[model samples]
Target chain A: MSGVAVRAGLFEQTDAGVTLLGDRCRTCDAHQFPRAGICTLCGAPDPVPVQLAATGTLWAWTWVTAPPPGYDGPVPYGFGVVELPEGLRVITRLVLDPDVAPTVGQPMRAVLDTVGTDPESGHDLVSWAFSPLDASVGL
Target chain B: MTTSEVVVAGVGIHPFGRFGDRTATDLGVVAARAALAEAGVTAREQIGITFCGTAYGGVASGHRVMSALARSGGPIVDVEAGCASGAAALMLAASAIRSGQHETVLVLGLEKMPAGVIRSSFFAPWQEQAGLTPAPAYFALRAQRLMATAQLTTRDLATVVVKNRANGVANPDAMFRTAVTVDEVLASRLICPPLHLFMLCSPNAGAAAVVLRRARPDDAGAGSVRLRAAALRSHLPGDVLGEATPLSGLAVDDIPAASTLAATAAYEEAGLGPDDLDLVECQDTDAARELLAYEELGLCGPGECGRLLRDGTTAPNGALPVNVSGGLLSKGEPLGASALGQVVELVRQLRGEAGARQVDGARVALAHTVGRGANASVTILTR
Candidate 1:
């Protein structure tokens, strides 16, 4: 199945896999997600677009039962901070079942999946999330 | 004068709860009028400036409030700094008085939030789309981390709720006056993992107002309370792993949070330390966040909050007696009025007017708040 990203410039999906897009400052060696025009760490005026590691480790996780406004996803979903090998962390929905309890320091690999569907257009709203590398945890 | 002494001449509040028919303007007017009357200034013309803090009240909120009171003669400013809006506004009013820019200033905080979960727009659109926008999600995440590091359990979190609710029973102005047991808190529906429904505050409606003036000669002998320090701080770069952060967070550790920075500045400016505080009213948006605040405000050592809770070090009769007003947990957070509501409680404690919840011989008190924008404010008041 094919679907578009929920937001632009966050990540790209291709035949190979999904790679998170980010900005790295050449002058200061700063890293940020969502491609910043300037380096947030060093105030450098120039930043180069860089692809982040697709796999990371789950540092912390939570089950969000109460949804926010405009949320069109299943209730009681799991979301957490995934720490990439590069050291920066990105908050993403953990591709896990609501009843599944995630442990800290678990290996996680980013996967492009459907977060919700636009009711009018009937198009799946896809975003990147981290799934347990272990098949048992993924279930 | 580089350090002019500022005093809180008066304070007022419209009870925090669902006032379905009343608008933010009405609440603000009522509180402002009571504050003005308490200051012995019957005429609003005596107020040289006014600052109104609100998150939802739209443009010219201060102007609308001033016009309602027929006090539109002076400069009126509307300030928004997330949940610290009221404290920020009070800080501004105190600064104007300290700088000799105005003799008398009125600070008002008003809010009328929508029912149910508070949907904040502070996160990026993508983050929101990923279902990370509900306020409690971040709180639960933080709580989970704290539980790991501080060796706290769900029972400890529930105990915090029970303590605060018990304190709330004595506060006439608090929204939830009924107390809850630990079992009840634990049984409450889970909004976010590690955070039960009763453990978190509701986004409700209310308003708080205070009148500030330069300390006069007679203030020395009177019962008036002086504002020793009103300090505000914003989030620093690389400190993004906590509440209200967007998609990305820094890898670095040991970066001080906004609350610590604000508290340090406030303590320095007030010539006091955590040990000197007679009582406190830190933001208890959730049960665990209050534990984090104990460390951030220098009330206890890091990772020592669990012990503090077990020993009742922050209970009404404990060493610190934090949030004796029942806090946002009991008051149902009206973002704008939240911080100033803390001040009103501090005033009551200091003046010995807090009938049942009063801490014995309270002289120095601190009110702390933190919210979106990573804004943190700590206001120290002394009698």
Candidate 2:
């Protein structure tokens, strides 16, 4: 379950679980994923980094049948918006059961998994993704 | 500065479709020349400035087009706002004319998009690798939400394609001329759940241009189309899931979308409402987006778009005929040329030149486009 992260500064894997790295505004309490130096809502500089909630509700979902440019992942993979408890809706890759269609309001939990392979380095690319909480043990 | 009424002196377009050998400058020059000819503007000094709208066109795209025409002395600025690029340029041109800064200004929109599904550089390399780019998946995700909350069904989505493609049959400039049935559209390949192949628009090459000038007293009697109102707005903060932000937004925030903001401002500026519009050309990047536009533009109430379509209110012969020029769904979205192309179609219809797709007694029209960066533009024109 260990590999090179697709990108740095996005998420961290600990013995406890996978948590996304984000920033929270000290002034207005706004949250941003992939962590920003300044708060977009209040324009407050130097927002502090924080770990986002591990679980969220599915806001929307879809299956990408065709691969986008530079995407070396499996075709027809699940993708969706997950609204975390902190009020941030994060767009992420979805790990789903083949026969189950995703529905709004379903509970999803974050996981670090292989999303694709880097075309240049030929290494398995790992990134933060979400999976149905009740469906399976792991992606 | 004394403000003046601005009029669309002329409009021209290069047909929308795939053009393998043609460059963006070539497409832009042809449209610009036609617009100049139609406006009776022969001398280069007659044009005070030039604005070009393009997303894919490279550096100095406007300069390149103007140089090609040998009319390069004036200020040639290029504008980009994703799919709203043309509308943004037109907004600037109209403002210049209204402020009396220039007697005449030329606006050109052109694009030579790369083949296959659009690969915008808007996303970071990691985002592209993660498959979060604004492509079919993002569109499908939005459509999925609409279906859940707006009473939109997969069948309703098919009906939009059916209506627009049928309308495209009448527009020679449209990329898709053949009418498709709901059955055929539904039977097409499913790019995503709830969205079929026909539901999406093709990104291709095309160009459209407009000539704006301060209206003279004689123009009142000449059936000239006046630029009644032109408004552009960007996405407000806190809708993490809204089109504005690429990755995040506050889920509970209730800010209005860019389309609503732009439409509201345009309606106020023109002293008109949705009831005043006789026809409309809205962005139909996907079938569901057109329906979403219905609510966003105030044509119908929220969660009421499905009923409006089922009741045939947006049809060719309906009370408010929309996309009579086939929209991006049929004409194919060249990004930069899209909104200006809609303007060209509206001008033709107002002049009684839209032979097959004419809405009877059409007098007022609106063109709406929204795209990446969450930019939205709404333009109202009157005969």
Candidate 3:
């Protein structure tokens, strides 16, 4: 599956499991989260891609009892705000338990999960997710 | 700032309990009738505009209800901005009144949250897929942050519930009047870590409506509460992923960005300072959040809200009464209706109608409401 040409939406996947391929702003040098077509900080065209780590520490986490409205994801899933070493905090499902009690200062590893698919277009949408890594299950 | 005058010509609230005799629409019609009667208006036919705010049901939901009331055809609009939807619609009505667009406007909020634990697929696709629901999650995240940085404990937060529920007990309008203990709050089923089921708002079905118009000749002389300042803003530009990045180390204070924008705009509009506010309707989706709002809204110095709670400063008879409406925590959040209900309660307090839990001489009140996408609104009322 490594070279499966996984119909990515033109964003680069980090070896650390972060799927957002982003560019660095030449002006501000700020690293963007989701891959950008241009430097969001400077409006500079064609920002470059920088590989990121697939794991981060759990800054905070919680159980999403009810998703907002009209989200078709599985119920009772755990979600957390993971803090990547690169300095971005992003939200993604913690695919471990319905009761993933993500405390402060926990270790988290990133992965790609299927978000949804459009039947008419037949394209699969994938997004980033994180899981707490057990000490016995180190990444 | 020059102000456009308006009055709460009438008010209505359906009872807050699980009675399956009627649907959300039935609940809405009931409140609508009560409002028209209280306003001394014959029908929606006299009203030039209609605004309904709800998040739980159908599209064109408000319009359908307007038609049900048999008073359609002016300009029926739908407003949904998380829990602040009702307040947002009221902002629109106030705007219309000031501009002389319409004299009498009916603004109502209705919602019927499915029974029991509020779970399931009701989120933005990215958010739902990522797993950050509403209320408890945000509150838990804020609580965790407070625990990490503010040196607050679950016990301090529990007092918010104890006080608000006690406040709810006095108001027959509140849903859960049975007061609970901090130990009870601590022992309840954990929704997220320190947050327990008791510490959070209940999911209930209810509708609250308000009728507004230009004040009558004698109405301004007595028994009328006037609108002061109404300010609403979404969270200022910032990445809100509660710590998915290296920057998660920064506290809301350190950022000095999101809440600052909202507080500045709110205070500026009211032409008042935090010192001027006698009572507040701060968001308390959970106990932790109630404390955070104290800091964020400048009621206390950052990181000292726990001190305020533990010392009984935010209690019912405290210096500044907070959430005399039992807040979202004790009263439960019905999405669209919850925030506006906060406004209604503030109007009651400023009008000296809040019977038992009434602030002794509440001359000014603030109602802070938030919606999805980090939007925030603050409304101030004075007697």
What pairs collide in candidate 2? B240-B248, B240-B249
Q: For this target, which candidate reaches the highest DockQ against the unseen true structure? A: 2
Ranking by lDDT: 2, 1, 3
lDDT by candidate, in order shown = 0.87, 0.88, 0.69
The global Cα lDDT (0 to 1) of model 2 is 0.88
Kindly state the fnat score of candidate 1. 0.71
Q: Is candidate 1 or candidate 3 better by lDDT?
A: 1
Candidate 3 residues A51-128, lDDT tens each? Answer: 555677777777765544544555565656777666656555666654344466788776655545543465554555
Off by over 4 Å in 3: A1-20, A36-47, A62-79, A93-134, B1-3, B43-45, B70-72, B116-135, B216-219, B241-253, B256-260
lDDT of 3: 0.69
Worst 10 residues of 3 chain B by lDDT: B242-251
**What lDDT tens digits, residue by residue, belong to model 1 across residues B260-336?**
99999999999999999999998999999999999999998989988888998899999889889998899999999
Clashes of 3: 21
TM-score of the first chain alone, every candidate: 0.89, 0.92, 0.70
Q: After superposition, how far is residue B43 of candidate 1 from its true place, in Å?
A: 2.1
Superposition TM-score, candidate 1 onto the true structure: 0.97
C-alpha displacement of A118 in model 3, angstroms?
14
